[model samples]
Target: MAEQLRLVVPLHGEQVSNMQQLVSVMLVDDEIMALNNLKNLIDWEEAGYTIVASETNPRNALESFHKYRPQIVLVDIMMPVMNGLELSREIFALNIPVRILILTSYKDFLYAKEAVEIGISNYLVKHEINEESLILELGKLKYEIQNTETNDRYLRQRLIRHLIGGLLPPENLEIGIKNKYLDFKIGSLAFLFAKIDTSYPILKEISVVAKSHSNFIWDIFNLANDTEYMDAIRLNPDEAVFVIYFKEEELKETVREIASKTCKKMQERFQQDYEHTISIVPIIVDNKNQNIRNIYSIAENSFNYSVYMGKNIIIDYESIPTAVNSSFKEVSVILNELESDFVKRDSESLKNRLNIIFTLLGKPPWNPEDVQNTCDRLVFTLVKFRNKNSIQDNPSKIEISNLFNLNSIRKWFESEFISSVENAVTIDALRYSRIVRKILVILHHEYNVDLSIEEIADRIHLSAVYIRKRFKNEIGITILGYLTKIRMEKAIELLSTGEYKVFEVAELVGYSSSQYFSKVFKKYSGLRPLDYTSGV
Candidate 1:
């Protein structure tokens, strides 16, 4: 027979002698049996630092520490009442340099180090320590605690500074395209524009998909550090714009494949989760050195073409017919109406005319492909008109210039005419009014000093007379009146802050004298500055 075997049971109970009052001992732990064993193992008097009381509850440790002001504390790493680290932090807050010895399992060394960093003096490995080792470590820590000072008062201030330093604001497309740290070289370059069929909520789903599948798209496109791709999707509630960068010419097929796959995956993944369809426009980047804005235009035009041609189809600009047979007479009539409506600020009428033009171009039942073809013709025709006007403005009698070349016309249209159209439309009457609002803000913020009207005009890229007229028409006030309003508003804010006297506030916000500023403020707000702040 095998020798009679005795299995060792973990020590789970504390033993204390009746001579406990001579040196009080405090043990904090979540495991009742373990806490009891620790109490039994340590001889309080031999260690020099006496634990005043023993507690299993961590929340009670703070009150006990404050009450006893104990010279030593033993805390467990894993506790139910409160974690040892949290309890140590609270104890440190009391401005007491008590020797905190951590009672943790041998497996808790990582946590023990962290505990020590938070002001714990010694980390005692439980189930391995006996009376001799506990007293030896505690005797050593007692000397350190006697000379230590608690600097825990500045903890929150340091934490807040670190948190603030970690925060960063988001960057938009301008920054993304210009970021030098980001690598943008890929094997081949291609652009995909994804348009969502529903409103903003619906459009947000595709944006989520785009971000999720970004790595898949990059891998499928075979992008590398020296050869990478960049993509951006400007999302509206109803529509979205997507632009991609890859190796020119070579990656066209992969781009189309990835784009189509992405759109398909997005549609299927989101259809059950959301109601939306994502359509894609695939365009090849022919010139990497060309302006990014030009690449943007190509992608944008291709996307618009996608909407016109059909939904969810990849259309290449090079494959499309350069010349389409259409009646320019009808197109010219439509353009005249559009030009007049734009000048008159009749957006409703312009939208109606545009709809009619699209309809006429589509013929019956409205094939979008035909409409796209017709719009291309319209753009070409308008570009030709602009070049003819330019030639007339700068007449050259040189016979060599008369030579006909289609390629030259195409380049001129892309490089010059398209940009001109963008600049013209972007600052039209609608956008002009927004610019005036921004100008008003600038004026109010800087009214006390001399601001050059020419400089302001140059900033907005409009003539002085044009600025004055447009500002007046849109705002129902001259630049001076608007500036005065802003200055007066600032004066009221300053008076309310109570940091300055009424007279000082007036001068600070740009008025030379308090009396004049008060009179103007009264006229605008139905009360003088002093009376207003005084509740009169």
Candidate 2:
């Protein structure tokens, strides 16, 4: 068979420890059996390294080495066409930082000396080679590589922070550019900010998820480094920002397209692999005056629009309107209408009025803080309405600050605040009428037994006609209608226990006929008793 080379990489969603950044490795041996032995010597991935490629021919190994640029290379001393020492010399002459290990059966000191002269990292006699010795050598090399990477990363992050804070002097920036740390050119630039849309149970800490997100984005942009230089940094526990530097000023539209595609890819991969939804905002820096601090500020401000535009979306900075519309007078008028609707106990009108408020606040030119304050005021009004009516149900414990967007806020108001207020209003209407109260008590207590308006009126010492009219007027339902509601609710509770059959539940909830109960259950719950039980 011809010389073979194979490449491998980490599979997607593989769990890797935070301390283990994978180091790439290549193996070159003339003997196919020796190559197989070396590959099986250790679990490369478990040891914090990956066997990216293996070649059986020295010449082919050299070509693959140049193509892959692996950080570490393991080669046999005896090879056809070119010896391992000659290949090491060629690799060293290329001026790349690569560690080379020599494997051979010869224990001659002169060969070892020659290998050392060629800058080989270690020389292992094939007879003495085992997993322990090989791992010891690879461990040292991995430590050195990690130290170098850590230092470079710290320096790069410091420089980026200084640049964004407007603290980097011109001279220092020039030095950074010269050292290839910045790699910026005279051209257009953009800032892309990404934030997680929801907190997942698996990722407990925001900082851990943010760091992973940053690393993932860095890998993607680094792959596209041929067209632009991208620098990514984690801004906080929940957000990461990227600075994109273009080589040509005329590539303005290209910058937008590239940024959009990069963000789209990040969104897709994170969602697919981790079940996360991230929102990204890309802000193109003003070419006439490229102030790093101002550009970053604009990018952050633009991210707030995710509340209205929604999660897993891309919002361009230019698309946001800058005009300030801080008029609270209109908001006060709407609040007054909302209070009126609440006091009148008109649930539909109250919901419509609340929706109108969200619509007006959700529009552009309004500060998010102002919108939050307006929502707080609406909550306060509802709370006051509940207290005035003496409704004892506590307001929902949802924190307004934790609600990130207008949609979530609207849901909180409807499910937590408005629903409680409507229930309180219904109770207030029923509390003043003794006849209605007595009728309700009888219906709730005697729901299992056969009940009638005349029977309830006789127990309460009132006329059947007066009791029916009063209960209907106070509760907005006829006496028979209310009894049926209570009986149906009790039937559902009993059926949910799975301890009673349809005929048995009919007797337990005041329905003498199972067929009549089934007909009534279908009308109330849109399912026959048997169908509902099957689902349960």
- RMSD list, candidates in order: 30.0, 19.1
Highest TM-score against the true fold, candidate: 2
Poorest 10 consecutive residues by lDDT, candidate 2:
1-10
Per-model TM-score, in order, reads 0.24, 0.48
**Least accurate 10 contiguous residues by lDDT in model 1:** 1-10
Model 1 agreement with the true structure over 47-93: per-residue lDDT tens digits: 55455677778888777776655667888878875788889899897
Task: Give the per-residue lDDT of model 2 (tens digit) for 1-536.
Answer: 01211211123445434223568899999999999999998988888888878998887887777766688999998998999999999888765568998989879899899988778888989989889988999999888876765554556656766767777544644464435444434356667787777421111232223335545544433332222135567666566776665544345676677668777866777678655577888887546356667777877787766666666888777867654767565666676556545644557777887788888887667566566567667766666767766767564565433455776677667665567656764775567476676676567556678877788889999899998788878889998887788778667756765667999989877888999999999999999988888894
lDDT of each: 0.52, 0.70
Give me the runs in candidate 2 sitting further than 4 Å from their true place: 1-151, 165-183, 186-188, 198-229, 248-250, 285-289, 363-370, 390-408, 426-431, 434-536
Off by over 4 Å in 1: 1-183, 198-232, 239-252, 268-273, 322-536
